[model samples]
Target: MHRFKILFVCMGNICRSPLAEGIFKHMTDNAARAGEFEIDSAGTGGWHQGNPPDPRSVAVAAAHGVDISTQRARRIAVGDFDRFDLILALDRDILRNLRKIVPAGETDKLQLFSRYARGIDEDIPDPYYGGREDFDRVYTMLLTGCTSLLDTAGKLRTS
Candidate 1:
């Protein structure tokens, strides 16, 4: 079977991107259990390169029954542009950043996560502010996006 590589991106790897990574992993793993593809994530900035995701983000992901504790934050490498089949950005700035570096020949791999999501017509709101509630809510928002993201990946894989 063919496995598709996916990379989720955000400004800082510590929160939203990792959360999207985890949620997407959970959704894809479940799909794999029933037959599906592969997934991963990264950040556009290297600031949090070796750091773990914010504890609050971890707690929220755990609440959803997904384990993201072991996933360390990493900046998107130049090579990742060639590696990932899909590159989903969390918001506009990162999307713009990705566009700048996505190589003139490889820009087709980039797409906003929300564009793949039917009802979510905007950016995946960053939840770096507020508290646990913010993280939890962002998790829910990303959950829908992840499911929608995977459903799209599934179709391309089978077709």
Candidate 2:
């Protein structure tokens, strides 16, 4: 089997995107062989560049027994277009922004994160300025989406 690289994207790397990255990584790690898939995330902008995932975001993920304390904020770069097999955006705006940067040949690799969600209409909401509940809600939403994503990616990997 071949290893596939996935990049999660959002307004900032500190919130939704990192949560998705952490959740997806955990699911994939427990499902497939040691190196079947890789997950990472970055922001559309560099506002939080060099920062760690938000305190609430880390706390929420840790509460669920997932550690996302090591994630650092980064802005999406041109090289990321080539590095990741999938460039997943948290919302329509980020998807649109990604579309502008991805070349024609690679556009198919870019997508809305909800495409992997099983039965949800809402994308993961950013929890930068909200309360702890917001982070908790995003944690749940991404848990569903990332698990679904891992299922699909794992299937593609096995078959």
Candidate 3:
């Protein structure tokens, strides 16, 4: 079976992207489709490299029964363009950064994570400086987006 690889990106891997990765992984695992996908995350910047997700992010995911505490922050690498079937950015700026670094011929793989979820036509807000409510909001956005993303990926896999 060919596994579809998905990579989520944010400015810092300690927040949004890690949440997306955890939510997507949890959803796929629950659907018994975990083996059919390769889900991971990275950041557009490298400041947090080797660091675990922010404590708030870990707490938010844990509240929803998904553990993202183990995921480490990593900067986006050139090889990721070829490694992932889908490269989803948390916001427009991240997408632009990714576009600037993506090798030619791989631009088609890049997209905004919000494209998957209806009504959420903007970037997932960064909650790094906000309170619990912000993290909760981000978690809700990620959940909706990841659910929609999995649905879309499943269709692509079948076709």
TM-score: model 2 vs. ground truth: 0.92
Model 1: per-residue Cα lDDT over 15-81, one tens digit each: 9988988887787677653345566778888888888998999999998798999989899988998
Better of 2 and 3 by lDDT: 3
By lDDT, the candidates rank as: 3, 2, 1
**Colliding pairs, model 1:** none
lDDT of 1 at 41: 79
lDDT of 2: 0.84
Among these predicted structures, which one has the highest lDDT?
A: 3
TM-score per model over all chains: 0.91, 0.92, 0.96
Q: What lDDT would each prediction earn against the true structure?
A: 0.81, 0.84, 0.92
Per-model clash counts, in order, read: 0, 0, 0
Candidate 3 wrongly placed segments (more than 4 Å): 117-120
Which portions of model 2 miss their true places by more than 4 Å?
Answer: 32-34, 119-121
